[model samples]
Target: MGYESYQQLGVDVADGVATLTLRSGQKFNAVTWQMHHELGLIFDDLTRDPDVRVIVLTGAGDAFCAGADLNWLRNQLQDPPTPREAREAGRAIVLGILDCPKPVIARVNGDAIGLGASLALLSDIVIAVDTCKFADPHVRIGLVAGDGGALIWPLLIGYARAKEYLLTGNAVPAADAVRMGLVNHAVPAGELDATVQRYARQLADGATMAIQFTKTSTNIPLRQAVESVLEASLAYESMTLRSQDAQEGVASFLERRKPNFVGR
Candidate 1:
């Protein structure tokens, strides 16, 4: 598809690899609700394309993503998200990435916060730049880590470490992330693209069925775990959207100040 065809993402295919670039530019590539919808559609389209052997996902410009867009959050605050929308969007994102038949590689070029971190963790292999940082700050916003964070982080780095990072919302450096087994590799910023491409090419040249089947087999536990907690966490996240703390969280973020959450 041409660049004009996408509003929030850019898609390009070459050498049996399909690259999905988050197109929000340097404003940290924050995802709007529309972008989430488009992402689901992108994956759906990719699933049907036979020539595509590997998928590489990265953000356009500097940062990978900064989580939800501030403008989108403001709108969502004014009109609280319905449970139906929450459940559907959440399921679409997690399932779309997890169930992809092709091997997905996350090329974390820079900081990946919130949903961005979750996306990286969900990928079959994650290669992050040395300068990259990962964090999930859902608790800081008085919300649960509904979208993949709660489900994937523990599987990657163990429950104790995952809980510490999630609760504290502290950033994890790329080297430390690799050491903790949160990422497959951490290379210099300049080598990030080449490294991901190299890996992608290797996968593309390998036995397609073997790679696909192995990926499917490995993801069974994750798929089951996500299914078990998805509904409850999504519902809880939506309920929090209606709370005073959620409103405060958005307002504080917009105002560039600490939130005075009343915990209603």
Candidate 2:
């Protein structure tokens, strides 16, 4: 199948490794509405691409994705998605990653925050640069971490650890994330690309169907969690997106001041 021109994201294929790069780095590859929707669609195409034996996702610039675009967030604050739209969009992004038959690897180049953090963690394997940071700060923006953050973080770092970070919106350095079992490898910045290439080639050269089948089997629990939790979480998140607190968050972000969230 011919590839669609993924406007904000970039896709390149060589030696059976398809590198999907988030290219809007000037905006930290933040999730604009189009980029968010495209993200949901790309995985389905990648899953079927015979030329792509291994998939590596990373940002083009120093930062990975920075979550939702601030402009988009401001618009969302004023005109939030309808419950149905929110549920469907959020579910598509989450399920797109979970349902992909291929083993996707996240080459975490730098900061992976909010939904970006979810995207990174959804991968079959994750390799982070030692200086990269990981965080899900939705709550800080008066949004719920319902973008698969609730589904995966607890599964990776346990409920207590996940809550400690989720509730506080703290950033975890790459080394700390590795110690906490959140990422597979944390190598120096100089080694990031080579390490990802080596692993991608190794996987590309190995048992293809076996690895794919293994991914499917391992994702059963993930699929189940999505089935049970995603819709509700996204629904709640949509509701909150219209809340007074969410509006305040947008205002505070624009004003570059702390939000006075009164739990409205």
Candidate 3:
């Protein structure tokens, strides 16, 4: 299948805004390797697509992306990548969103957990429903919040707050998120699309190159931070993947019970 044959995503472009919807609602828009790779490539194509001036990422149904599919995670046991390989793949996904030339707005219609939280928070602007929640639960799954959480969280909320949330893997409500500087706006569920469209069109209609270049300029710090912190954090996360505790964590999750973690 071609790159256009993205199985896990749905795209609709109208009036210069491309709404990219995660279509796997049955799994709360969970990410698989394919979905993650598709996300990495979509940004590169959308950056060049003349019809698209802005991109808004959202999820179908009641929740935004919950996280990586547990089944997908379990399947990794069959053909696991090296720490470096996994980290590089992860880097691509995060950088694709950060480096996309078109303004990307996260329309967080509902729950944004784990990597979903990162995606929403990483966008140029995040517009979330009032009841939507954000959290990075990779740690709760016996992994570090290394993927994008460690990278983007501290940059938005302070290092102290980032550690508090990432370590505990607690859900932050939409209003609290906005108050803590984690998201740009929170509105009623009915107002989400309109609010996202209003801001997206404003960005699309503004001085195009100016807006794009401004995004480029402002992301310099973020780029530097990625180089400085992301790999090291991912390295630690990868180390934890090899632990017995990690296996138990997944098993407990699948068993629908509290994890009995004995630090190994």
- Position 15, candidate 2: lDDT: 80
- TM values, all candidates: 0.96, 0.97, 0.96
lDDT of 3 by residue, 127-246 (tens): 999998999998777887877899999999999999999999999999999999999999998888789888988988899899999999999999888887888887887777777677
- Predicted candidate 1 versus true structure: per-residue lDDT over 35-58, tens digit per residue: 878876777677778878999999
Q: Rank the candidates by lDDT, best first.
A: 2, 1, 3
lDDT of 2 by residue, 1-264 (tens): 566677877888888889898876457788888889889899998988889988899997788989999888888878888998888888888888888887799999989999999999999899999988999998887888888888899999999999999888899999999999999999999999899988898999999999889989999999999877777778778988988888888789878999999897
Which pairs in model 2 have colliding backbones?
Answer: none
Off by over 4 Å in 3: 1-3
Worst 10 residues of 2 by lDDT: 1-10
**Winning model by TM-score:** 2
Looking at model 1, report the run of 10 residues with the lowest lDDT sum.
Answer: 1-10
- Can you give the lDDT of residue 85 in candidate 3? 84
